[model samples]
Target: MHAPALALGALFSATAAIAHLACIAIGAPAYRVMGAGERMARAAQAGRLQPALVTLAVAAMLSAWAGYAVSGAGVVGPWPFTRPALVLITVLYLARGLAFALLKPLFPGNSATFWWISSGLCLLIGLVHLYGLLAAP
Candidate 1:
């Protein structure tokens, strides 16, 4: 079942989810440091709920992705559409990583540092997922 690679992918996703949650708890500076964009940071500083809410949603999604990965690894009970979910997650991460340069224009306010770091992390996670898929019986 390619347990190792899938487990690694799950770990990465879980870590990312934790990071997103941390950004919300740590407030504006955390948002800025995480390359969440100045708008989000400003909104956080102004005590608005939008930034936290959005970050929470992202964290939840990442957590779900992690669950899927773990399920594929057989570390957890099988989830509905596990194979398809893994495929979509892998594709999304790879695309986001590979297209960071192109995506920069769409998220103009995000720092270059953010795009580069996040893209690299995403690419690594995607590769792990791909390896797991390829190794599956």
Candidate 2:
């Protein structure tokens, strides 16, 4: 059970990271061509992808938490930073997702540095979770 959970967590984290990176890359071109207003309009019109991405992001965070909980239970010493860091990362991911959803309208254009930076952060957080999984017992 533990092994499977860890594997699943790693998989989720990696997938989330990759997906966000892709979004940032692809969205860049879209922003360049259409401008933020058009891009936001497209996102609003399409509807499906935004919600799906949000769902996946949330799932990734949840899986990371589950993995940490399982692995932490087995350890004897205090994992002072690991658990809190996981929580913080999860919050960051969630906050970014929410911002993307709500502020999609204000996105400015494909050149939006904010989007790129946020996406990169998402990938970094995912990598952090992956590192945690590797370090776990």
Query: 64 in model 1: Cα distance from truth in Å?
Result: 0.2
lDDT of 1 at 136: 97
> Whole-model Cα lDDT per candidate?
0.96, 0.51
- Residue lDDT tens for model 1, 1-137: 69999999999999999999999999999999999899989999999999999999999999999999999999989999999999999999999889998989998889989999999999999999999999999
Query: Which candidate number would show the highest TM-score if scored against the true structure?
Result: 1
Q: Report residue 21 deviation for candidate 2 (angstroms).
A: 6.7
Model 1, residue pairs in steric clash: none
- Those runs of model 1 whose alpha carbons end farther than 4 Å from true positions after fitting are none
What's the distance in Å from true for residue 1, model 1?
2.3
